[model samples]
Target: MKLRRDGESVYVRPMKLDDAEALYEMRTRNQDFFQTYEPIRQKLVMTLEDYRDRISDDIQHWRDQTGFTFGVFLQETNEFVGRVSLSNIVYGAWKNCTIGYFMDQAHNGKGYTTEAVSLAVDFALTDGQLHRVQAAVMPWNQASVRVVEKVGFRFEGLSKWYLQINGNWEDHNIYAITQEDWNK
Candidate 1:
C-alpha cells in the first residue's frame, strides 16, 4: 500500500529482484550510520547477484508464510528509502510477529519511518491475520523509539541483551500493539 505525508508520496511494496541495485545503493550509503544499531553485515562488499539471491529468498519466505519484507520507496522518483519487515510470524495459538525497519539517514526525522511502520502494522493485523506486532529498539536510538511510539506501540519495558547488534549484545526497549489495541 502507498501512504502520503506532507507533499511526498511513499509506497510499501514487496521486495522485487529489480530493486536490488537501489537497495544495494541505499544500504552501502548508510552502512556506517546503521552499523551501531543494526546487525553487522557478513560481507564487506555486496554484489547485485547477492542481492538478487536475497530478494529471491525473501520471496520464498513470503510464499512460505514465514515472513514478509516490504521496501519503502519514494513514489515520485522511485528512490528506495528503507525496508520494513514482519518476521518470526507464528500462527495458531500465538498469532504474532516482530516488526523491524530502517531508513536512509538522509530521510531521518521526516515521518517516513513511522508511515512505513504504520502500514506494516495494518497489513499484519488485517491481511496478515496477526494478533500482535512488536518492535525492539536500542535505548540510544531515540529516532526508532519515536517511530514506534508514534504508531501507537506502547512501551513494554526492556529486554536485557535482547539482540546482537554490530557484534555486541545490546539492550532493547520492547514496544507492541496488539489487535485488541488496534481495535480500540
Candidate 2:
C-alpha cells in the first residue's frame, strides 16, 4: 500500500524497507524524550535487523488492512521527522480506529504534528472508509491535546488509568471525531 499525504510543511507516507536506518536513528534520538509520553520500551531498537523486521511488520499491517503506519517527513528536505499511525481498526457495526503519533523533539512547536494528524484523520475518515477516529492523550501532554483539538476532535471523556506510560498507569483525556464530526 502506497499512502502519501501532504501538508504545508510536512508529508506522510509509509516507511520503506530502506528507511529502517532512518527510523532507528529517529527513535533512538528521541527515545528519552518520547518516554515521558509513551509506554516505556525495553529497548528502542535491539538491532538494525530487528528494527527492519518491525518496519516490515508495519508494511504488512498496512497491506493487510489491519493498521496503517506513516512516517512524517519535511517537505523541503524530505527528512523523516516523525511517525503517525491509525491502528486498532474495527469494522462491521462500528467502523473505527485510533490515531497515534510522535514528532522529533527538534520539530516540536512547529505545527507539523497538527498538520500531519489532520491529514491522517482525512485518510482515516475518507480514504480508509472508517467512521470514527480517536486519540487518548495523557493529561500532561498539552501539546498532543492541542494537536487533536486543532484537527477538530472533541473531548469525549477521561479514561482512568487508561494506559501505562513509562511504567505506571496514567489517566488520559479521550478525544474523538466521527465521520459526522469530520464533515462539519
Q: Write the per-residue lDDT of candidate 1 for residues 25-55, one digit (tens) a residue.
A: 8888988998888777788788878888988
Candidate with best lDDT: 2
Error of 2 at 161 (Å): 0.6
> How do the predictions measure up, each by TM-score?
0.93, 0.96
The best candidate by TM-score is: 2
Q: Which whole-number lDDT from 0 to 100 does residue 162 have in model 1?
A: 96
RMSD of each: 2.5, 1.4
TM-score of 2: 0.96
